[model samples]
Target: MSETILPELPQELWRAGKLELAHGVQQFLQVMRVASAGLGQYLAEIESRGVKDLYGYGTTISWFADIAGLSMGEARPYVNRAIDLNPTRALDGTEIPPFAPATGAAAAEGAIGAERIKQILEILRQIPAEVSVEDREHAEAKLAGLARDAGPRQVSDLGEQVLGWLDPDGKEPKDPEPAQPRRELTLQRRKDGYWNLKGLLDDEAGARTAAALEAYAKPRPVDEFGQADLRTKAERQGDAWVDLVDLAIACPDQPGTNGYRTLVHVTIGLEELKTGLGTACLDFVGTMTAREARLAACDCLMLPVVLNAAGEPLDVGRLRRFVTPGQRRALNIRDRGCTFPGCHRRPKNCHAHHIHHWADGGPTDLRNLTLLCSFHHRLIHHGDWQVRMAADGLPEFIPPQYLDPLQRTRRNTLI
Candidate 1:
């Protein structure tokens, strides 16, 4: 390992690092960029050749992506660029500015020297064990500037200088920015047969949603709570719905395009899960009647109410469903929204999914559904993933048969 350079302290006596430092940092950066570009180039070449093979003539783009760790969307473009840059055989049998046009490698072509593309690879072989992939690329981009001046001797010196600065013993990085917001919940069943729950949202939604749930869950006083009548299930539910609507309107929502809020989901238990071996199914709250329940059992993420052997309400807490306002809120929340995983769907990009579908016995409760950008929902409905409520009354997923024989399950605990 070499040494780290300190910015000149005018009063301090000069050290010998001055010459070695700048040149070293510069050298390491250049060598790495060439290599990464080369890998990209190599993959491109293989794909071009592979696609034309008779046995794979009609191979789907996705099939190629699965092998390359790229999304089909990305693989297609990468392949195109590689074919255009085709840099495999220079007279000296090395890369000849293969990606110059697309990547500005021409100006850099002359900037790097001595380390011929072939020589650069040899130097890269001696790259320090601790030199990271990023370091390699950063050095490579800078090295592009050296395309006309550097030689193997400089690469060795550069390695020492870089390893000194990057992995300077015990000089760890500052805390990094959090990738996703912190959100989580715990649902525990008490001996009393009721669930005690707690959750955390990014900001006020956490408190607001919790308070709203608490209000609905509060014990009633001789049926004096709001406009509900326990004697009639419809009246009681109607009252509950009014409370839900009132809460949705008054709560702070980031608004949506269609004059409403984003949809919320309240996934209840599912029937297929209860069966264990058949296809998955869901039941939305708006149609929780037997007929609706029966139909919803055909889709994914729709929550079917769970009943005991004697068929009594289990107090498993209802899910929020989307009403028009909720939909507005949903659209607002997901302005550039699609709920399909990794989808970038906007308002024009989605369909409001019934956490419980209308065909199934689901309610129009905000907790009963979630908004899914179309592609993902279709994937859910027709692909390998099966989403349903778990024993805990939240959404869980079972991967399709094609993904694994072990049946890996996933959970989307965010409500």
Candidate 2:
């Protein structure tokens, strides 16, 4: 072919009308598609000649990456596309047809871009392996025809419908089971003392976990201060997991807790416990802020051991910190559920939270406590929410100014 040449654009190129500008851009893209097909053909020739022996590279993709300045990720699809579109000669010197002849022709003529080609190839791949060769070819041709007019997304949607037509039941033969169940989990402590968790649960476990988490993971209601749940789904799920662990530990019949429903032991200095500042040791494994220790101390979710500054055990007098059963029953009847505005948690799902933390010398009386779910309990301690007993002897919440410019007192109406 004669060498293709182009004249330089006039400075007025930028002043072109909308239709002219759009048409020029479209033509350029078509040129790119044609060049891509030519590149694919070259790559296929390299592959046929043996990539390693011809270019001292392990794979044709590696050679393309080095020469074309593309990353291996970008080069891999090009190499595969070439193999799928280009005919090859067998060892017996017989010709083998391209896997997708219609797609190859369209790509060579610049009628489809790389993305459309990829979508067509993917549809062809989904054809049942046991289907006759003619059926597979028909699917490929149909998809290529659709690609000529539709975008990749539309082509993909059509592919799904095609599957149902090809296999009405959409059921494939089950493969043999592997040696072990495909569930795995990894928890490792980082250098910063935080634990990183990664895991994969099998289908049943995953579904159960998802259902439980979703039960506790609804979006927080907009507080009276106009603050909605600002947390992302991931953050909500993390909080849900914490709630799940607490629920498991709170189960009276749980086997491993040795009659203590709590799972962790937090040891804090008497000063830290009272002041809500400073650090506390956690099960001798790591440390937590005294504020966190105070939260855990509430409802006695974590066994707390008070210590003097000298690291000696200190008697913290009578453990009147926990609300008595009768006091909890009264609070349950009074608050009904989480006293946070718009919260729908029931009484059974609540913790009797001390309005004034008991660690701060607040008494655990009916007037001093309110019912809060595990999520709201943590929010009262760690978030910007404030709670108090109203003059009428009922619990009320005060949203932070950011949530409510007026910072007005709000009551949960869900009860």
Per-residue lDDT of candidate 2, residues 156-198 (tens digit)? 8888887777766765557675445578999998879988989
Q: Which parts of model 1 are misplaced by more than 4 Å? A: 1-322, 327-348, 390-394, 411-415
- Per-residue lDDT tens digits for candidate 1, residues 240-329, read 444465334334552432333333222333443333323322223222233333323332222234544454544344432335654456
| Each prediction's whole-model lDDT (CA) | 0.46, 0.80
Q: Please give the range of 10 consecutive residues that has the lowest summed lDDT in model 2.
A: 1-10
RMSD of each: 23.5, 5.0
Clashing pairs in 2: 225-403, 225-404
User: Positional deviation of 168 in candidate 1, in angstroms?
Assistant: 61
lDDT of 1 at 203: 70
